[model samples]
Target chain A: MARYSILVTSSPFTSNGGANALAYCQQLVRDNHTIDQVFFYQDGVFHANAFMHPPSDEPNSVKQWVAFHEQTNTPLVVCITAAARRGVLSQQEAEELGYNAYNLLPPFSQTGLSDFFTKLHDSDNLVQF
Target chain B: MATITVRMTTPPYQGISAQDGLDFAMAATNYGHEVQILFEGEGVAQLAGQLTPPTGMKSHTKRLKALPFFDIEELYYCTQSAQARLTDGQSLAVAAEPLSADGVKELMNSSDHIVTF
Candidate 1:
């Protein structure tokens, strides 16, 4: 199976990218392909939020993603620039930076948007979902 | 190296852009050419699941899946875009590498032809 790198840069509820990103990952796993990583940038950082609460009746896409990451140990890296632009800060970081607590989680790590470059370079294939 | 990367710049269901993009990718793959799909801006929505297409429209996600049959296995999403704007995780169901600015630039560079829809 060929390995791939999928990038998700849209919000889950706002438009289309959110749902598509999750579906793509699931199919890849089903195909028995290796996913090198999933990088979150621009408005895509919210997927890393641990407290994302959708209605019980509604299918929880974010929760499903969390489970995917947890089960697969997939690395979900959030872009620091976009997160800061959207004012998504941790409790401690928010207090230190004079902001409100917007998100807190462990499956995600914050870094520069440029960090994902190496992943793309080394990837056997790249497809955007 | 006539590798082509199909870049999605529009959101799904907004218009025919996503469908059009998929059609083009499929055509290329059917011709036995290397094809890749990259989502930027709102294009990442193409991978979002649970979408009810407007009226008679078919889901772009379904079309996206068929790409592999044509050997168009390259699919990517902007991780930065997904995290910053994505409201829910269910919408994005693909395995992707979140791309940075540099990654995008490099993708553009590596591709022999970049088609944006």
Candidate 2:
């Protein structure tokens, strides 16, 4: 299986960007490709927010992502700089920043863009959406 | 040798994507990685000269000049798009190569990594 990384840079609800990434991840695993990680940057960090509760009729992206992670064990990482500026905080960061709310979804880690380049070293390809 | 192609298809001032894309190319160069910057679609406008930014915003249009110094030199703008939007007598601030549609595909195909912004 070839190793791959995915970059999600757009918000989930506003567009199909996040969903498309998720679908690709699922397909990748089904195709037997190894997903090194999914790096969420810019406005894309919103996919880490567990607070999103889309209407029952509409597709729930985070649910799909969480389930995808469970199925593939693919790691979800969000850029800490982008996440902080957009108000999606990690557990420790929310406490440190004195913010009462933290919406970061579980199984997702807050990381730096430096980690992105490092991950690229081992990843065979980066399929950005 | 891994050649990374960074496609800047977004405009400046509207968001940080354009600036960040440029930054990635610079960083890739510093890390001893080969990178090419393609200003396509709306990104074609980012290279135009004589931009006036409303106070406090970093002028990305002007920042293109510094890119050559960083050794990230293969600056490209789409020929079709540039010909359409760029007004007569206006030129890009950077020394960029104009790529045709086929050229765009060939460049992307040759690159090891294609990062779109």
Candidate 3:
């Protein structure tokens, strides 16, 4: 099985890209392919926001992504600069930025572009959405 | 080191995709990777020489021109896209090579990884 790294660049609710990416990842795992990392950049960082509260009947992308990470043991990374610029902050970032609240979901770590490049260097395929 | 081709299809300043894509490419080079940038679809508009962005917005043209300094010299644009969008006498700000559809496909096939924005 080939190794894959995913880059999600669109918001979860704004477009189908995020959901499609998640679906793709699930398929990859089911097929026994190794997913090295799922790096969220641009508006894709919204997927890591713990504050996301979708209607019960709607698909909860954030929760789905969190579950995917739990099952597959893949690293869920969000670009720190992009996440901060879009206000999706972790507890440490919130404290540092002097914000009262944090929304970065668990199992998802904030990182730099170099972290992504390192993973990409090791992966056989890099899929973007 | 791997060769990573970053394909950009979004116009500049509409959102942060262009800047983020560039940042990703630049960072890849820092890790000793070779980066090639391809501007296709509306992304070709970003290469127009005389871009005057709205007030307070960062100039993508300026950043794009600085790619060579970062060792990102493999800049390319889709010839058909450029011809359709760029009017006569409109110059490109960067010295990007024009590639045919087949050339683009070959570039993607030859790269170790492909990232799109």
In DockQ terms, which candidate is top? Answer: 3
Give each model's whole-structure lDDT: 0.71, 0.84, 0.89
lDDT of 1 by residue, B1-117 (tens): 257788888888886667757765776655545778899888877677777789898877677667778787777877777766577655565555668888888888988556567
Candidate 2 per-residue lDDT, tens place, A30-70, comes to 89999998999888888888888888998877778888888
lDDT, residue A79, candidate 1: 67
Per-residue lDDT over B27-105 for candidate 3, one digit per residue giving the tens place of the 0 to 100 score:
8998888999999999998888778877888888898888888899999999999988888767789898999999999
The C-alpha RMSD of each candidate to the native structure, in angstroms, is 15.6, 1.9, 1.3
Question: Which CAPRI quality tier does the interface of model 3 achieve?
Answer: high
Let me know the TM-score candidate 3 reaches against the reference structure.
0.95
Tens digits of per-residue lDDT for model 3 on A1-129? 999989998898789999999999999989999999999998899999989999899998899998988887889999999999999999999999999999996799989888888777788888888
Model 3 chain A lDDT-worst window of ten = A117-126
Q: Pick by TM-score: which candidate is best?
A: 3
Worst 10 residues of 3 chain B by lDDT: B14-23
Better of 1 and 2 by lDDT: 2
| Candidate 3 backbone collisions, by pair | none
| Residue A2 error, candidate 3, Å | 1.8
CA lDDT, candidate 2, residue B72: 82
- Alpha-carbon DockQ of candidate 1: 0.04
Q: Is the docking of candidate 1 incorrect, acceptable, medium or high quality?
A: incorrect
Model 1: chain A TM-score against the true structure: 0.84
Instruction: Output the lDDT of residue B75, model 1.
Output: 79
